[model samples]
Target chain A: MLFGLLETGFVYFYWGNLLMILLGGGLIFLGIAKKMEPLLLIPIGFGIILVNLPLGGLMDYRYELTAQRSGVVQEIVIDETTRFAEGTAIVRTNAEILQSPVHGRLTSIEVQPGQNVGAGDVVAVIITTMQTDQSVIPTEPIGLLSRLFAYGIMWHILPPLIFLSLGALTNFAPMLANPRVMLLGAATQFGVYFAFFISLFFGFSFEEAASIGIIGGAEGPTTIFVTATLAPHIIGATAVACYSYMAMVPLILPPVINLLTTKKERQIYMKPKLRPVSKLEKILFPIVGAIIVILLVPSSAPLIGCFMVGNLFRECGVVDRLAETAQTSFVDILTIFITLTIGGTMAAENFITVSTLSILVIGVISFASAAAAGVLFAKFMNLFLKEKINPMIGAAGVSAVPMAARVVHVMGQKENKKNYLLMHAMGPNVAAAIGAAIAGGVFVGVLG
Target chain B: MSKEIATPMAGKVVSILVNEGDTIQEDDEILLLEAMKMETTVYATDGGKVKKINIKSGDRIEEDDIVMILE
Candidate 1:
């Protein structure tokens, strides 16, 4: 029986494939055991092994000998004419078309042979179905429900359940868009500057320091894009640090908030100003903000532009449809890709080091510092201001939007039942979004 | 119709501190509503004498139900 198997010529190649399998196994271990961004890294690591496996020419096109004539049958199976297994990642030799998940709307493509296309042009509108499944890379694309099976049972059920729970646990969205909440978020940003100096001690350049400092901001897209553009070499560590800290927000923020401000300060009663904002001011704010940001920091334009556009869409009375899309679907879709890419960039080799440990530490500290700075600034504002703004609401100045602000409101309401800080927090909350963007632009213009 | 202190959201009205025909100021707390784990005050948007209070402590209310009619 062994001799018969030896005659089939499978043993040598199978061993070779086994070694490749071992390589894949190593990647999985790195992603799973080491926790090096499992979502993207594990899939990519498995993909590497799966593509390399000599599965009797499954990945490629080939012909073989016929048993009747000499050996196995030789016929053209997969060829240039044959299309890719739908949804499988195939390198398009033709670089004319770009495939993008347009705001979660998946599109199908119809193509004829030998069509000329340019780089960065839309080839097809493929469905942007998110399947976090590693085992079924070669399988045809499935809808979200079916693909949920491709991933663990947890992946499908957890998201909606978690979102629902989160909606209930802490509805931070209102705070996210509010201005005072922004101040609180900004207060946490001193962490960025503090981290910047610390990274300098670790021998990072100014640009690298700025990239690392932003981890305190707890905004993933900003961190990833900044790191990718400024310090591509350290992108891996920076991203991992950013994400791990973001996940730890609940654990990280409270202790810092408590340590910075006393119970007496937290319990301070803030009389509601109840200032009703006119519709015209809301409309004018975004336009004026855009103009100011564009003039001051051209480099920051992209961040401010997208942000203001989203804000403008929300504020603009005429375009309810656009506003809804911007607030809900657009931001949500971008978030998935941004997180995946951020996770993907953190390779095991790049992430596991002393520098990464420092980045993570500093990142947490940066968030705390920003929160502190914001509260201090608010306290400072109280000295001269007649209204006697809540010092807690000042922390909302950071651009975490409604989350930081809502946290402030929650903390306030806990202290006194009548306090409603949500609306008051909105003023500084929106401002900080622009502030952070401008700061981002300044970093880019000076350093880039 | 007897004036009712209605619930804003579908939650227990844990406390109804006011009686019918009680003079209340605008922005004065009318009743205490517990919803989504937060105690919300149903304040009087307009100040008037509360007439014929229909809801007492622990009564439930729906959104936009007539809580009380000021006479």
Candidate 2:
């Protein structure tokens, strides 16, 4: 019993795990007590605590699992863990077949010889030391969560699926009522560019700056899509920052609106009843929007295409069943995994860097700048329009979805109790989300 | 002339602010609707007397559902 106790993970415990666990606890507190994005923060907080536990092995890469008694690292011929039959020779980068010391029956695999393999369904074992007489050494992947991350998130599958769910949930009626609010959404991208330059000034690589800057729009799936492609190493930081700040939009956006607009400007109101978008117009938007955006930025095809397809499912009116499922169960299930997997990436080793902290700072700056740009642009637009806009609604273009819209609505109500701005704000709310998606596509187009 | 006011979106009727036969002004709060976990105040579209109330507090409503008729 004493010997067995000694063999447990307690011996390897360190200060980092304790600190991260506390940090994770703080996130849980914010989600529950503060009611700040509980859906995302709760799972992510729990994931952090779970991943940081000693010897949990929840985040071990597949290559780290193989025990090498004696071997030299070799170049990777096939990075993917596709099917390999028993007794089939392993191919090297140089096209030289790996010679087995014995007739080894190596079947199940998800690996690269010398490099860390991402998520895979099979075990990747390369017979590194050919003549060492260590024949047929099999390996079991230790981390439970790591495999999920590698197979799901790392595969670039979940982000588009999430976008599909988002499209299904969206109501284009708001955006279509006022097509000009769409410009406010585009205006928010100024924050993306501003943050990119700031990150670059801080000595981050061009790609890293692009990925980090996307946090401004506070579109979680888009941030994940862009970061995963550009600066994958910083995904844990960017994702967490994106969500935490998104939850704080209600708090973050109000001050910025106050700074830029006068009391008279805040009290402005628009008509409650939109022009009432026809169902035919609703059904055509996804199709037309996809064509224009994808044509302009071909690299954004996956994100925008999936989003528009999902939107089509919602607006077509024929597939109510598919639309309902996509909106509810499909989206809820994906949110659990995507948020949890993101939290799983926040292990002490990956998250506690000085650079990660900087990403957090940059996130707030980008988000604020994005909201500011939207308000400023709306003010600029007022100069030419016969009818004035409530500049506060422009802040909804930060794309925190209904949260940003609600904040704008509430702020409007405070200024004038009779004002009904929610529907009007929704126009820019949805537009901001689209603008962020397009911004992500621009990055992927030029950089990816 | 009389007109019926329908909710433009789906939500739960949180509370009704007017009693039957009460006269109201345009943009007066008739009821509060909660949708997408946010509160939305449903305002009277035009000044009229509340002739019939079709929805009570905590009733789930759909788009274009007639909630009240005003004369």
Candidate 3:
């Protein structure tokens, strides 16, 4: 018995589990040492470690079982044999053979010898019995993280909250200063649809394709929100793909932007000053923007609504306290919980699959295509505009936020030292965020 | 009446674009405030000579707080 106990969890250890642990550790190292999305990656990495630990029971869940049937079997048949068969006589002989439908496993037989069992009686206690952990039987409760995860992510509360906090932190000046730049934002969404078609070609369902396509939006919250609602089974892989790609935007987008735009176009200087936005305009923007977007894509209302409301808190000039909370402490708390649960969801069984690999590849392609499309579209637009907007800013339209915009700024400076494109890039950068939200809403509305 | 230029929101004054006694035109930017990672330019409400300045670069101010007086 002691030997059996010693070998319990060890017998279940496999190469997959080891690899997952290493991947988790790698994420932790990346977060702490490399300082890549440390707020999210740290919790997520730790959660992954906790979940992958053998016999940790952090992921184990159990529930109560109630009896569904009361009467013992009156009929008996054994290989067409005409044995002593009818009434209580058969029941007496075959009572030991009875199986509880509620609990698939056999427990101590509830019915004692010559005892009558009634319906609704607790015939057998359904215990969580797993081969991985022979010691410490689980009680009748689901895992705490599992429950929080189900209620938080699966029920669709956390994503919008994250958006709300994001909105509180965002300043709409860039987008408002140059409204036409929104076209570049819309143009980048071509990556989403392009990847959608590609995923469909790979035999993914319309829902799955849509979920995968949103990765090109380059917004982690929107990607998670859409995937959790549509293709929930793949949330783990898709979210990782989204965030990993987002962090790699500086590396991924420049080549694509450079390849699409010539040195002349890259050197093109835009007027540095933006027309100052009025306080009234800033205050009205969130309210008006929300109404228009929600009306157009009701499915996107949750994320967009929260985002606009948070922006309202920032712009209204009356709710600085609320905006501060939303942007700082509240968001920090949500990020920890959300990332940890997201990481916990990626057990070896769920993450190490052909589908995960495919999603990762498609995610990168989606991001590349979005960046390329943005730059190409800008060049297309330059054909008509006299001012000749720099095409590099188009690459910022992929919603990787300031990172993509910064890449454009760096490229612009390299081409011409006098040129300052950070603010110019920001216009498309912020617009891309809205564009991605709209794309996500459309996908969910149509396919969800 | 001297026109008092006030900030529209709370933020750190990143720069004083104009100096006291400097001639300014209506809508000319007098100062820049950095808030929420975006810059807002505080413009002269009425074209006049700068009279008294209430805030300097790197000083924090609240909404409706007088930034400068123009005469």
Candidate 4:
């Protein structure tokens, strides 16, 4: 059991996360010192650093029945007759008891030589206690009630309290205005549902299905919140799967993209026509879209409401302060609580085991499938259109903001130098945001 | 192949730093432009001879619009 404590640390600790923290630190250096996407990368890197710190209990343990071993320093043997005798063994069989001392550093150095031992002046001491001391210790009847109350409060009461708070922080309203983008985003979400259904065949429950479904968004906070609400049981594994895959987006997305699309398709030319969006259209889009979505799926109202509210502020033209606050200060503050709540929810008993590994696999499939769906949909649309739309821009359907759009743009330019896909792709890019929210709403409405 | 830094933003080409066939190196300032109340410089992209000078001073340009081509 001495090395058990260290093994617990080693097993629970993620070396990949540790590496990510280092990678994040490097990104921060590149952003701040080298001026590469400073506005985004710095916070992201810091977020990576804070979230990756190992907490001993992220996943559950499967305890197996085994022969009880005596403490390393002390060995006790009993005959078969004495095995059932009263006071045969102070320690129960198969009970994990920490025989070693839990050391505490001594404070107040006043040890001259060896003065008479005082009541309170015991300097350094090793507190040796059994790990199952609570079961062994005899207490009053009230103590049982208190323990029961503590367990109830800690296990059941605290989680929902944290969940509701996180739910309050998320603003899903910005997804209202760009219906086209939202459609694409929602279209892309087929990957999540597809993965969800497939995982059920592999033996995940409905709640776990719901948890795995939201991994398509690649939004950590949203992923955590959905998993926490829908499947609090598997919150740990779900969250780990969510964050790990989200971080791996740059790595994962490119490979999936490369494998699916041919080089000729990647280089498709897109002539972007710059049509200045009217302020009236921008303002009206959110209000109309929100009403439609909220009316359709009330379960997603919280996320949709907040998202539209942000967009409303952005296009309202008069409230610069409100829009700035929503996008920056409000988002920033909420992000901290969201990340912590998400991270804290991953207690070991909730996470770990075979189910988590399956969820992670399902999440990857969902993301890849969403991307493939988006590209194929774009190609299908191109078949009917007179003015050719670059099929590569179809990839911007996933609501990853500038990253997805940039990928499309980069690929388009790779095909033809005359092609400028960024602005046109932004149309679908913004639309995908709405699409994702709608899909999220549908998921919640049907399954939540 | 030699490379030319085109107009990054909509601007008017204000002054020509090098004429046709003028030799320039990478990161060398080639010409200046006036746009959005700011003066911007077009840079030579490689260590090579300027093969062509397409625009002179006072020519209008847009974002990513080719200011010059080199070989």
Per-model interface RMSD values are 7.3, 3.4, 10.2, 8.3
List runs of model 4 lying over 4 Å from the truth.
A1-183, A347-350, B1-71
lDDT of 2 by residue, B1-71 (tens): 88898775668999999999999988888888997689788777677899999999999997678999899
Q: How much is A432 displaced in model 3, in angstroms?
A: 1.5
Instruction: Kindly report which residue stretches of model 2 are placed more than 4 angstroms away from their true locations once superposed.
Output: A1-6, A64-142, B1-11, B21-29, B43-51, B58-71
**By the DockQ metric, which is better: model 3 or model 4?**
4
Which prediction has more favorable TM-score, 1 or 3?
Answer: 3
lDDT of 3 by residue, A324-409 (tens): 99989999999988898888767676677788899999999999999999999999999999889999999999988877887787
Best candidate, DockQ-wise?
2
Model 1, C-alpha of A115: deviation from truth (Å): 41
By TM-score, who's the top model here? Answer: 2
lDDT of 3 at A279: 93
Better of 2 and 3 by DockQ: 2
Tell me the docking grade of candidate 4.
incorrect
lDDT, candidate 2, residue A39? 89
Q: Write the per-residue lDDT of candidate 2 for residues A265-353, one digit (tens) a residue.
A: 99887756677799999999999999998999888888889899999999998998989998999999999988888888786766777
- Top lDDT hit: 2
- What order do candidates take by TM-score, descending? 2, 3, 4, 1
Please provide, for model 1 over A103-157, each residue's C-alpha lDDT reduced to its tens digit, 9 standing for 90 to 100: 1222233232344433333333332222222332223334322233223122222
By TM-score, the better pick of 2 and 3 is 2
Question: Model 4, A240-349: lDDT tens per residue?
Answer: 56555544545566666677777776676554334445777777766887798889888667666666666677777798787766656665654444443433333222
Residue A227 lDDT, candidate 3, scale 0-100:
87
